[model samples]
Target: MTVATDTPLVDTHFHLYTRDMPITSWAWHHPPEDASAEQFLALMDQHGVGYGVVAAASLYGQYNDYVIRCCRKYPRLRGTAFVRPDTDMYTLERMKADGIVGIRLFFRRVPDPPDLNSPEYKLLLRRVRDLDWHVHTLVSSPALPEVIRAVEEAGVKLVIDHFGKPDERLGVDCPGFKALLAAVERGRTWVKLSAGFRMPSREAARSYAQALLRVSGGERLMWGSDWPFAAFESGVTYGQTIADLHDWVPDAATRRLITADTPMRLYFGA
Candidate 1:
């Protein structure tokens, strides 16, 4: 399952968190060790990853100072930040100028997910669209329909985190996954083949990955290491995550599309 390609690989999703950073809220247990940008970049170099996108962690809530700083410090890195719905356009502009390409909506463990149909939320989406930014979403299967409709209506490019997080028991046939496939077909949406460990089982992960490839093709798909592995860190390693991509997508050409070509277009605008 080795892929030989000249195009540099880009990890489309990862996070950078330091203990010193303020934690306004957390989804689960706080990471035992700091996953600094320096450590993340070193992992990328060690694994030959050329560039990466630093997804804003939910633990840090609306505090994006660390992620913004990393994007400014590292020329090869881009970032997404967590911003409140009432976040000023001028402040968003400042974040954009600092190398933030998107904003994250964390719906998984948060007590209250924003109401997409609300005026403020819709206005935020409009601003994001105007700024030429995408929305990175993390939600469970049941929440996908509302998320998809809102994002589509807003006409914003969307990136779904963690394979659309379909229910493990239902696999690709899950209603939410079906909606995701349709969204991919409509264009302006991309899915990350990442955090496979988050899926219920390896078999379910493989099924969902293959279904995405069959329905949406490699052009709309991307790969990510989910570096530092979050809650699964003790069991999942960077090398293992990269290898999982090889197992899920065995074709070298398609692998190139996911690992380098598509990500370059999506994150680096190459």
Candidate 2:
């Protein structure tokens, strides 16, 4: 778990939801788990992650206070939120003050939260754009195209979580995944090369990460540990996740671009 000083990197897809947050009440069926800020920071220190993006989890519903507090504690960290349609510009501006860089729509195993093209959703995106906040989508592979089109047309930068949740059974070149790459190439889109197990490679999941890197220009991709790797308790490890990056991306410079430069540009604008 010793992270060499020279290669210190940012974890772009970490989550934070405390046990007190009524996590079980939310529609997302995952049981409540304790993931405190202090524990998270310690883990980052152990693993050599210099910073992290504490994205809002669906289990928290509209509550973002915990994630906001983490950002306040560490200047190097930032966050994303789960917001509703009627969220006003004033509210978004306040969240901006609180160190939130974007608003997320988490759609994992559940139904899509809201139609991206709906009036409420459109207005939310427009306001998010006005505040210059990016839109984070934690959706399945099948919903990527529609969400991508909606966010892009709204002129807000979009982030795709879990490498499109691609169907590993179909291989990387599957038509739906191809569309995801096309969207990234078109600009205005960013993909997180996280969640290797969710991808369809029964043998070695690393190939799934490689497929995303092949299509997503290094500048448009970000790396994350997806820490506390829920449901992957037995096999996942921080070292293994970082090592997988090697297979998916072969060059040192490209790895730096995806892990460091891209995240800095998007989250910190450095």
Cα-based lDDT for every prediction: 0.88, 0.77
Residue by residue across 1-270, what tens digits does model 1's lDDT show?
Answer: 344233338998899999888886545768889999999889889878899999899888888998899999898999999888999999999998888999999887788888999999999999999999999998789889889999999999999989999987788888999999999999988999999988888888898899999987787999888888888879988887887888788888898888888878877789
Name the top TM-score candidate: 1
Q: Candidate 2: how many backbone clashes? A: 1
Error of 2 at 238 (Å): 1.9
Clashing pairs in 1: none
Stretches of candidate 2 exceeding 4 Å from the true structure? 1-8, 24-33, 202-204
Clashing pairs in 2: 168-200
CA shift of 26, model 2, Å: 5.1
Give candidate 1 regions above 4 Å deviation: 1-8
Tell how far residue 109 is off in model 2, in angstroms.
3.1
True-structure RMSD for candidate 2 = 2.5
- The TM-scores, one per candidate, come to 0.96, 0.91
